[model samples]
Target: MSKVEDAVAADAATLGAMQINAFDANQPEPLFVEPYAVTGWATFIQRAASSRSGPQARVGVIRDDSGNVIVQGSRHSLTCLLHIARDNDAAADLYGPWQESWGAPPPDMSKDRLDAFFGEMKAQHKAVMGNVPHICTFIFPKSRGGGGWLTAPMTDLEIIMTHSTARGRGYGMALLQWSNEMADGFGLPLYLDAGEDVVGLYTRVGYVRQPDELRTSKSLVPMVRAAVKV
Candidate 1:
């Protein structure tokens, strides 16, 4: 395998492990079926790597010299990100006080949702950075459809903290800084979605609330199921 291919595989493995670990650590009831998490991430990694637009999407991980994977983060395709945000607990936490939110947790291996999300993402792949692991968990950039604004564009950062132990370690800041530099390099306005608890953190980094655009939802079914599974 080429070096990049090897890297992608390693990253996929790391991310899969981290996702499972994070879920186990934080959820009162963990829902990952052992093989599913690993296999699922592997599938994502392979597909992304094989795609023509794959290289532009970055995947990163923190590892020891022994090459053991530690932390992993990803920037889902815009559509994937949208779906993720729709069902994301972390996003809900960030937006809870602002407005009521609702959605079901993503069903496992929902072929239709996955296919549609991925297909749309691939069609707009030029604007996407595939599941970036660590040091910019989830950042996305977009251009206005009609205006064709050239000099400046808009970008969004969506960071997810799956492990409590990973908090306060500066990893989050590192990721934010990396993302900001990337956006600044492209001369795009940086945007983000953060929970109320971490508002101060983002504020310190120069992010402001888009209060008018804020909306929230709660999924009692998913939440309860997650609790029971844990």
Candidate 2:
């Protein structure tokens, strides 16, 4: 994973809502896909037209538990993003029925609905960083690694969660192990902004916590770790 093998970019496909596409021929092919994340996100938007009570459209789910959180993406293929972007009423027709599901009153649909969604996506970008296409998502029994844009140097851990009912069972560590494996394979480092409670966790797991010198908020602790084994 340390040395780079040069490969030319051969094909690019459309991934829904992602600024970047996946399956870059130049980079290594991903080993698995996050079906839960994709289904979760697509269901959230698709059902938004019918019911707002539906679960969130993010993250790969733990089959044994009820918690899931996607970090930088919801798994919409570029094809999906373009489909919604091209049609004006498509987005509203998607998220409109779920308006009451929102905590506040719905926004004006009289304006561009796609723009409204993009606005929300932009806010998400601030939290997860720009569209990080290359990510390896895994949940216990099933595991798939690879599927990301090859341009970036580091891989984002994104959001890691274990249901309250499932905590303390080493699930979190298992997830970290998966991330480390990918980093080892790519010869890159892993980067994430650790929250207060998890700062100790990152330290114990081998992530070098960055100083708060440039911290925008007192709560966030930035950390990084070399993916390759020393």
Candidate 3:
């Protein structure tokens, strides 16, 4: 039997390796930097697991009968910033002292490219959602300390991936259903930006894709699942 359990900081390295193995092929863009991929993932997982004051961030891993993690997923509420903003010059140089502070690897893309990418993403998010309760897939911390997007309260299924060797099973859907339960409890709509290949899966769980005109890129489609009380 398989069971879903909360992922702790010690699971970071394992989850990082799993992440690299799972998303390495056919990713729209490089999801993690080369040498720093594991480090970056470890940092993110550690922060999410340890930080108590920020939006509620939870990670769940599905373990096989032998206790091997076959799937990992995360959910976070977008109620407020994880940490307060501080002075920063990192925006000008993304991979400098600020990078150390963030303790995570920056995206594989260049600073200019990342800026343009995030800029368009933010624009689309603002235009489509417009101050409504929503969740986001990505957030960057400020240079001086911890920080995150301050948004209207909503639940987000941030990352959900099954191990490459375990893909044919229903682990992914199980994780999605787990997140749906939490979103239902919050009584706010759940939102995410889905990759083209997986949009159908999300749709099956009540995620309605946004208009094509709202897309910032051809590969990503934003979707929302309305809150439903159980």
What Cα-based lDDT does every candidate model obtain? 0.33, 0.33, 0.49
lDDT tens digits, residues 1-230, model 2?
A: 11111111111111121211222222353222333234334533444244333222222222222221212333211111111111223223322332332222223222244345323422322333232322211111111122221111124344343322233446556556555655566554555554455556666666776554544444344565655743
Model 1 C-alpha lDDT per residue in residues 1-230, reported as the tens digit of each score: 00111235655555545555544444454444446655555554454356332112233343444455445343111111111121223222322211111122245535454344323322222122223211112221111111100111013232232233343445544445454455455443443333334545555655544433232211000000000111
TM-score of each: 0.48, 0.40, 0.66
Best by lDDT: 3
lDDT of 1: 0.33
lDDT value for model 2: 0.33
Q: By descending TM-score, how would the candidates be arranged? A: 3, 1, 2
Better of 1 and 3 by lDDT: 3
Residue 220 Cα positional deviation in candidate 1, in Å, after optimal superposition: 16
